[model samples]
Target: MKINPKNGVDQLVFGMKQNHVENLYGTPDKQFKDEDGNVIYLYNKEKLRLTFYEDEALRLGYIITSNSEATLLDQKVIGKNIVEIKTELPFKSWEQEDFDSTENHFNESNWLILQSEFDVIIRVEIGAIINDNDEFDWKFKA
Candidate 1:
């Protein structure tokens, strides 16, 4: 399935299925049964995660990496439930002390939707990578 660059998260979730997801990302590293007897597939690579619940994709995570650590680029919710996203990175940075901490260096944007009494939130962040560049050359949908 083709992903709409303007709304990549939505396109991903809508296009995902058991066969399509596995074909694109390959077989999951681990698989197990949940309490409800549904199968859950987990793939934890350096910068990618494709999780499936009950043979349906529940979440997809893609990480963007720099010289240091990697930051998640895309996260999509597929189930009929609410989910929360979080990061352990602090909110402040001490540039004066050469600490270059994540605190105060994180930048975030989000898209939220409420449909059929279910809420979905897509959080996008640039992390420390944004501070290193004076300008960005992203091309959005026209």
Candidate 2:
């Protein structure tokens, strides 16, 4: 899968509706609501989880993949260590989570986040970028 920072992963652009997603990937292996009530659709075999905003719009707000084949900026990041990812992506200007030193999640201004566990990347996620006013600026409006 291809990752586009602040936009989407592959063809799943931000703000797409449920039907659009279903059309592209078929039904999810499992579907449930997260703690915040957002809808989460998990594709077990792909190790992909898509989160949709809860409202009349029900737009896709997040894309996450644990697939080892996923790539970002032409660099394969899954299963790589933080140091390797930083070097490959040349992860400049990424803001590290300061709340806990043990946490290895790093987020850029664009909202492309690399989540690591024990120094190894376990997940790659892309979502809408926060605007200057601190509001989500969705790339698509469908």
Candidate 3:
């Protein structure tokens, strides 16, 4: 499935309500709030976690996947190193951050974030695009 940056994964867009997603994905294995109070819907079978922003009526904020079969720009990303992932820089640029030695690289232009462990990408996330007002871009609404 193509990860549409600032839009969503496949047909699921950013401003879609939880019920809309549930209609397509069925019930999540678990639904709860995160430390920051963002609603989270976990699908253990798919190894996917979806985050929703509280300010936007719980519309999807981002998608996190550890699925080994997932690909970015038609290239396998999970388990690949930064050097490998950069073989073709899909975005213009990205900013790197470190947490407890774990590396996180994010590009605001495309809203993609990669979390790496031991130099290997352990997870990939695509988030909602924020507008000039610092709000989720509801343009992708269903």
Candidate 4:
């Protein structure tokens, strides 16, 4: 599927309603609220985690995956380094730590973050985060 950062994963969009998500992905494998009150729709079979804000809109905030089979458009994402990844999906502006620095997953410093209208983060030796702030307070929220 084509991964459009501005729109969303395939047919999904940043401001799309929860029903739209259900229509696109079907029923979630699991659904729960995070500590901060965001609703998480976990599709274990699909290996996708979709998090929505806790407001009237309930807009999508985060799209996360650790699945190696997942791809952004035709680009294979999992386990690839920044250089190889860039060749597939080149980003102009990014935030990252020193290559030799120890990982800090909580802070997400180990990943290379490309924050535009949407936030696309590629983790070191792991997965990726395709996020959208939308009406959220910060550009990049936890």
lDDT of 4 by residue, 27-136 (tens): 89899999988888987876667778786357775666655655554776555554545555545444444444332222232223322111233432211333355333
For each candidate, the alpha-carbon lDDT, in order, equals 0.31, 0.80, 0.82, 0.53
lDDT of 2 by residue, 46-98 (tens): 78899999863678988889888888888888888877787767557776663
The deviation in Å at residue 10 for candidate 1 is 11
Clashes of each: 5, 0, 0, 0
Predicted model with the maximum TM-score: 3
lDDT for 89 in candidate 2 is 73
Pick by TM-score: 3 or 4, better one: 3
Give one digit per residue, the lDDT tens place, for model 1 in 1-142: 2222222232234224556557666787776766754444554652333333333233222211111122223333222232232233222221211123212122232222211122322222221111236432222211
Which pairs clash inside model 4? none
- In model 3, the runs with Cα more than 4 Å from the true position are none
- Number of the top candidate by lDDT? 3
Model 2 residue 128 CA deviation in Å: 1.0
- Candidate rank order under TM-score: 3, 2, 4, 1
* Model 3 lDDT, full chain set: 0.82
Alpha-carbon shift of residue 119 in model 2 (angstroms)? 2.3
Question: What are the C-alpha RMSDs, in order, of all predicted structures?
Answer: 15.6, 2.5, 1.6, 8.0
